[model samples]
Target chain A: MQGYIVKRILIAAFTVFTVLTVVFFVFRLGPADPVMVMLPPNATPQDAENLTKKFGLDKPLMVQYGNYLKNAFRGDFGSSFRFDEPALRVLLMRFPATLKLGLVTFILSVTVGLSIGLISAVKPDSIIDRIGRLFALAGMSLPSFWVGIMLILFFGVTLRWLPIAGRGTPLHYIMPAFCMSLYPIALITRLSRSSMLDALKSDYVVMARIKGVPEFYVILVHAFKNASIPVITVIFGIFGALMVGSAVVVEYIFSWPGIGRLVMESFFARDYPVVQVFVIVVTCMVVTLNLIVDIIYAYIDPRIRYQ
Target chain B: MHSNQDNLLELQDVTTTFFTKQGEVRAVDGVSFSVGKGEVVGLVGESGCGKSVTSLSIMRLVPQPAGKIVSGRILFKNEDLMEKTAEEMRQLRGDRISMILQDPMVAMNQLLTVGKQLGEPYKFHDKVRGSLREMCIRLLEKVKVPAPESRVDDYPFQFSGGMSQRALIAMGIANNPDLLIADEPTTALDVTIAAQVLKLMKEIQRETDASIILITHDLATVAQICTRVIVMYAGRIVETAPIKIFYKNPAHPYSVGLIRSVPVLGQPVDRLFSISGQPPSLFAMPKGCRFAPRCNKAEKKCFKHYPPETWLDENHSVACWLYPGD
Candidate 1:
């Protein structure tokens, strides 16, 4: 198990390296130039050259790439051209907000999704099951931006019961977080429902019932653990995506000061350092989350042995 | 066949039905039988013969909404199980009655330790007060699982098929239930392992004096441990007799066919004796004897009407037209 974990970390490091390299080259090859974005429109060619030299942009691409890799290894991603501060520092500042939003969204979706899914599975084809299924269908198909707008209009404009946008008090998180959680909630509900249905029908579940376990205990303790395995994979994937700023649209709409919005604004401003650092961070989060999921699988199912 | 006072469990015309998309299908139709105290009754039948369904009915664990005990009484210790509330059944289950399912490989929760699964009966029934782990180990040791102390902590996947069967047996008898239902407990094991499991069950039964209803398609298994045999065909009992009479002078044609089908060792034949034709479908059952279509001796009367149970002796009965009256 220790060897397996070590191997996973090595692979994750390699994956982050590969992603950083690709993002670095992609940004360099793009039409947008950080030097141009930094310079005034009437600046002279000499001024441009001097400015390029100042930022070490006049060097060969290979040399620049080497320097970028070396500095990145030392946790010294250069200052954001837009923020005029260390890009890693800027990203880190936004990290907590995103992490909080991700965690809240995760907990919200998991509880609601798993509850509906479990209820639907336990009493399939009933009124509540049908309603839950309908909710899942709408949640999965509706665009998040649309859902966010609808929520804003309903609770913010029409009802005037809550704040419309931005992160502050817990109430401000309600609209954006719920909007962002819809897809995952729907996905988890569907996956968990089917998985639970299968688990409930399994021989072990029947054996538990025959053992005279209370119905609730049989469903929750005996069947739920087995059912949650597949759901956990999807859940972790969604959470990783959330952590990595995939909630850009919702964050943008809500004016939420999260890494997702930070990445978007940085990209438009030609803040290459910030964008590059964000990519690396996102890649690392995804890889780490995947490894965590694998480790969790070993605990949830004894049949899974990591050699 | 035993007196009511001595009977640990009695099924009086119990009929379990399943409501599927196709229609309502009677899985177990008007089945009546009894298991006396300390007796081991074998419920023998081919696949889809309602043997497993019968056991599930007794446990009140039949799959719900779609399947239910539509009619009849399941009397346990002279109490009607059919009349017991769901909560009452739950309390009775694992406390006084327990079941061992077929396919030991899949019959245990993979995520739980064997000890945890074994301790479930004690935990749920609250029958034992001491350390659950110690009791689980003792149960494992009783079932003859090697290295019970350490092995109890292992999961079901770590145990081999026979070992898993042993662990399941351990769990089944953990509460020392009054009635233990084992549904094809050894169907998934090798021949030798199957024999060992049967022997273990017999030993447990003797030690606990728990009446056992052993459900299996293999008559050889029945002969090894069963005191009485109840032969079923198409959700109905074809014959029921003491194991000795069942082997020596089986009455029903299906019973005779089943006995003949078991190949005797060292007796080489061109083809093993097999009862031909598939069992009737649940959707469109024959109006008469359910097994009439497959019975070689089936007459016009057999096809026109179902045969009622006819007594062959004081302790034996057969359902066949050939028996007539006395």
Candidate 2:
């Protein structure tokens, strides 16, 4: 198991290196020049040259790539032109907010999703099952940004129940986190429902019932564990997706200071350092999550062994 | 029918039906039988003949919303189980009565340890005062699973087919149930393993003195462990007799054909005996006797109406026109 974890870490390191190299080139090869955006409008060619030399832009692409890799190994990704701070530091500042939103969304979606799925499976073709199916359809079909706007319009403008944008109190997180959670909730519900239905029909479930296990315990404990393998995979997929994708539109709409919003703003302003670092950090998180998922599988299912 | 005094379980006119897209399929039609205390009764039949459904009906574990016991009196220890509430039935199940399913490979929950699964009845019924793990290990040892101490912690997948079946048997007998229903316990096993399992079941039955309903299609198995035999054709019971009488002078044509089909050692024939024609489909059953189309001695009247049960002896009965009801 230790060997397996070490191997996964090595693979994750290689993946992050690949993403770092790709993002670095993509930004540099693009038409946008960071120096042009960095300088004032009345700045002279000499000023541009000084800024380019200072940031090592005058060197060859290979040399810059080499230096970037060396600095990245030491957890440095240069300084952001706009923020005039280390790009990694700027990314780190926005990390807590995204982590909060992601965690809230994850908990909300998994709880609601598994409940709906379990209820629907327990009494399939019933009224509640139909309603759950409808909820899933609407959740998956509707765009997150549109949902965020509608929520803001209803709760923020007309009803005046809560603040629409920005992050502070717990109430501020309600809309954006909920908006980001819709797709995963729907996906989890559908996956878990079908899987639970299958699990309920298995012989072991019948055995449990025959053992005089209470109906609640039979469904929740016996059938749910058997049904959970696939749902766990989808859940981890959702987590990885939430981390890398980061609900960019929802963050932007809510004016939430998350890595997604930071990446979006940095991209438009030609802040290459922040953008590159954002990709690297997100990639690492996703890779680590995948490894965690593999470890969790071994724990949930006795048949699975990590060699 | 067995005497009421010694009877542990009795099913009177139990009819279980399934409402499918095709139509209402009476899987178990007006079946009645009795299991005496410490008796080993074998319910023998071909596939789709409602043997499993009969056992499920007794347990009140029939698949819901589609399948149900439309009408019946399932009397257990002189009380009508059909009249019992769902919770009451649950309390009785895995306590007074328990079942071992057909496939040992799938009967156990793969995610849970064998010991945990075995301990569930004790946990639910609150029958054990001591540690459940110790009870589980003792049960495993009773079933002859090797290394009972550590094997109890192993999952079902780690155990072989025979071992898994043994674990299931251990679970079934955990509560010292009054009645144990084993549905084709040896069908999925090889010959040697099957014999070992049967031997183990017989030993357990002797030790616990529990009434057993052994559901299987293998006549040889029935001959080995069963005290009495009930033969079902399609959805109805065609013949029931003591094991010796069932093998020697089988009454129903279906019973005769089933016995003839089994190959006997040292009396090898070029072609084994077999009954012609498939069993009638549930969607389209014949108006008369269900076995008439396949019976060699089926008379003209046999095609027009179902026959009533005729008592051949005090303990033997046959449902066929040849044995006219008096």
Clashing pairs in 1: none
Per-prediction TM-score, please?
0.93, 0.92
Instruction: State which candidate has the highest lDDT.
Output: 2
Residue B144's lDDT within candidate 2 is 98
> What do the candidate models score in CA lDDT, each in turn?
0.88, 0.90
Q: Across residues A1-307, which tens digit of lDDT does each residue of candidate 2 receive?
A: 6666677778878888898889888888888688898899999999999999998999999999999899999999989978989999999999899889989999999999999999999999898799999999999899887898999999999999989989999999899988988888898899999999998888998899899999999998899998998898889845776644647788999999998899999989878889888888878788778877877877878777523
DockQ of each: 0.75, 0.74
lDDT of 1 by residue, B1-326 (tens): 65478888999999999999989999999999999989999999999999999999998888877999999998999999988999999998888999998899889998989998998888888767788889989989999999999998998888999999999888888888999999999989999999899888888888899999999998888889998999999999989999999999999999999999999999999999998998999899998988889989998999999988899788899889999867
Report residue B288 deviation for candidate 2 (angstroms): 2.1
lDDT of 2 by residue, B108-210 (tens): 9888889899999999998887888999999999999999999989988899999999999888988989999999999999999999999999999999999
Error (Å) of candidate 2 at residue B91 is 2.3
| Lowest-sum lDDT 10-residue window in model 2 chain B | B1-10
Using DockQ, give the best candidate's number.
1
